[model samples]
Target chain A: MPTEPLAKRPGGRSARVQAAVYQALTDLAGERDVTRLTIPAVAERAGVNPTTIYRRWGTLQALLAEVAVARGTDAPPSSSGDLRTDLEAYAVRTLADLTRPGGIAFFRAEVSPDIDERRSGLRECLQRATAGLDMVLEASRGRGETPPPAERLLDQIVAPLYFRVVFSVPDTDEAYARALVADLFSGTWHSAVELH
Target chain B: MPTEPLAKRPGGRSARVQAAVYQALTDLAGERDVTRLTIPAVAERAGVNPTTIYRRWGTLQALLAEVAVARGTDAPPSSSGDLRTDLEAYAVRTLADLTRPGGIAFFRAEVSPDIDERRSGLRECLQRATAGLDMVLEASRGRGETPPPAERLLDQIVAPLYFRVVFSVPDTDEAYARALVADLFSGTWHSAVELH
Candidate 1:
């Protein structure tokens, strides 16, 4: 396995240590459950001392949170103008990533612990990924193609795909994705406006 | 707090111990995070010896898994003649349970390392809940209110609510419940079939 350095920045020794520790975590996640991972083993994989990792992340949970956020940041954003096409693309991509050899394994490790900080990171990543759907809804509203309450449209459309992913299940198919988009565009979304 | 006894038979010593342990867990969840709860504390709360708890449940994680399964088994079946109404009722009830004072706290506690068995219990509970919805869809098909491929209806109607519950910040308003039902029943759902 190639242990590439994390981020190339002109920082001090501490930055280097942080990068090495995160790489070690990724390596461990690929191999086994994060719950079974230990600080000593992480240090050995990173080729650093355990003390350095402790000083940097303070706790194993903290380390995992950082790694999760870093991994999320690396994913590219979706910006297709068409709502149905964009969402279908997003769902397919997300499903592909989650079902990959180590993908669900990594998410299972991170999500099993409902730590507030980690949950916050996961939520943020989701919001970032789905932000485009919100934009599409707004544009559709401008065109009088759909109703207002952009958040509901986005939520109804995008939330289920992630739900399936988190539960380690099959991906939502293209037909289902298109159906969700049709639902969002239909006037029925207006009925739930009171809920918001 | 009223400590509801779990098992009715209460003949076997092990069954009694399990019931007591579950009750203790419910009480603890009412007060604090379940992840931080210790074996001695649980034993004290249940008025049993710590050794007895260890002997029966093996570990805090195992005890938690058993408790989760017990709690999950109580989820009501989806019923009421109308598919939309049945699903709305189910969603409202689930939301109430999930957001109740001790509900989310208990859920977060059960999420932890080496707890796949506990998570699986949750999935099983979800499957049961969804199965109830499936029955509704099947009935709808009998009336010619919906198309074939029961799984599609299941995915469209049920998946989003669960997605909101597990992924998004939950919104349990009656209006939201109504809208969810309306959206599913609208022509948009039928449109998917035509498109397919």
Candidate 2:
């Protein structure tokens, strides 16, 4: 049997508006200093009403955060029932995405400190990403398997990948990503006194 | 006596010029967008010849990297005899520096990918920082102590702290920094088959 429509159809008007806005914002970011980018500018470029943009995104930083997440980080691997398999796939996919052309920029934007104050758009992005991982973890819990904490997965697996990229450290390949996941499951890192 | 003139007084003319340039660069960075910041502008602001900056830093990115390092990361903990103590102290110092007012901005500039393409000034800064750690590790090795690899220390201790900050994961305080050091020496993480 065919898959369930390959996820929900984004043919709705809202989706179209989102695409247009994202495209306009990206074009504007490329053309000018992002510090000066405004919601009205993005709305104008996208041909969307400023009120619609304001009502939906509330702030320019949130829109940037959403775009960054959508561009690189939102596409986690489909769950495979086994937590290890799921996590490894996710780690590998994250690694691949980060190393792809312009992927680092998207990742950098997702964590950029400039956009973090007041509204905390990046934090929202992180929470949404964490929620996705939590679903996989919850499924493992339901199956009576002791999955590692989602935070641990992030600390051990996700953090290192971004660290290596941001710091320009070498050897952040698929092998390294797989090794991080392996270390998490090997129970080595968890053997300590569990200091949270 | 008097801490050896506070670790060698920077009274030389070259040192004076260095300070002026760094100050000027900082002032300029504050006044203008960093992307548009140039060496000539900094030189003019400092009342120094443009060739002086070109000869000393070679590039604007290198100068920025130096400023970032000098501003926060360069002052690692003075190496005590014990490796654990040194690493913990260094980690704690780094945590404090990153959390200080305007500290995270310096760090962001240090790892900012925008300045990373050509001269790799940030990499040089990283090497300098790593070298300081290596001195501590080397002293331990000289005392017949088995020191962990420098890269592992960076990945485990340093990477996690910066990751927590950059990603806005909360609770990256002194206690967390100390715990990370504790984890490193606990022999738990290293128990796994060394992938590297």
Candidate 3:
């Protein structure tokens, strides 16, 4: 029988440290305001030296961006092969995730001054976040249906969700999400604009 | 001849002090990072004592919010009685204003931590920002044409502009703003989505 030390194996010391640190930062973030969070506090909670976190992430904003990217890049909703079905489900889930605990912090972290440079962390995060919609659009095209540019989806659907959340708009419910999708597929943005 | 002192006239000393402070803050904001701004710096530039600023505005965030509200409440674009023409002009102006020097700072100030509470500074800013859109919609209704809800215009027209600004999306040009208004009025969000 061959035995490998836990520290020397494939899913070993480095991976464990990263997971622990991510968990610690998320837990701390949930417990207090994100503005007051610090490396030492996360290090203590993760039971690792603060220098390790500093060496790996370089800065707290980078760490937060890493966490946000991880969360956003999680497996996108499996496409049901129907465009409307996929879009409605995606929209509903996106709204739910944004309103979750520490969600706004994650969003702010992604767009914070230090990470929002075009060719860096923000770009990667945005790409990952849009992967699901791209997949859906591609599948619709394969089915011989013309799909809107991914930019249009971003403009009409995703933009409104974030806007309502950021601006504290009161009507950002599931029904509103459905209405947007409905209005999109219905060939009319609003009945009032039909007069034009 | 009227011999009233400037201090005793209608738009007198108090108003002058406020105008000076607003100008000083905007100039400073354009020249430096907003995170580093301080009341003493604003007071010095405005030629007023720091205590007077503190007493009048309560906090730097309050001063920033006041400046934003004043800028946003400026006369809305005159309605041209043509919905498409009016919307296109408004959208173009909105995008241009947001991209101006110190403009993003004004937006940040309106949505910053201490000012975002409902029924507060944010509410007033939003109301003032949307005033022109509401007027256009009302005129359309009066012309025996159905107009979309003000919120729809907000969702379709306003949200995307701000989202692009905040996220640093690169395609936020005059043509993009014009396209958004065109698509909204055309009732075809995109040539692709029409297949559904």
DockQ of 3: 0.27
Write candidate 3's Cα lDDT for A1-196 as tens digits: 0111224545778788988988988887665345457899999999999999898787786788778666665655788989999889878877887766666666655555432342365566557658878988888999998877777888889889887876778978888888888878887533322111
Clashing pairs in 3: none
Give stretches of model 2 more than 4 Å off.
A1-63, A72-76, A111-119, A187-196, B1-63, B72-76, B113-119
Predicted model with the maximum TM-score: 3
lDDT of each: 0.59, 0.68, 0.74
**Per-residue CA lDDT of candidate 3, range B1-79, in tens?**
3322233544667878888898999887765445446899999999999998999888887888777766665656887
Candidate 1 residue-wise lDDT, B92-166, digit = tens: 665655555456444444443444743675566557556666666676666556543545544554555545554
Return the number of clashes found in candidate 1.
Answer: 0
Rank all candidate structures by their TM-score, best first, as comma-separated numbers. Answer: 3, 1, 2
Model 1 bad stretches (over 4 Å) = A1-12, A78-80, A96-119, A130-150, A171-194, B1-15, B30-32, B59-61, B75-78, B101-123, B138-158, B166-170, B190-196
lDDT of 2 by residue, A1-196 (tens): 4331223564677778888898987777654234336789889999999998999888675677667656644474567888778777777876776666544445545544443342265576567557667877887787777777787777777778877766668777888888877777655544542312
Per-residue lDDT over B51-91 for candidate 2, one digit per residue giving the tens place of the 0 to 100 score = 98897677675677667656754474566788888888878
TM-score, per-candidate, Cα-based: 0.75, 0.70, 0.79
| Candidate 1 chain A least-lDDT 10 residues | A1-10
Q: Under CAPRI classification, how is model 2 graded? A: acceptable
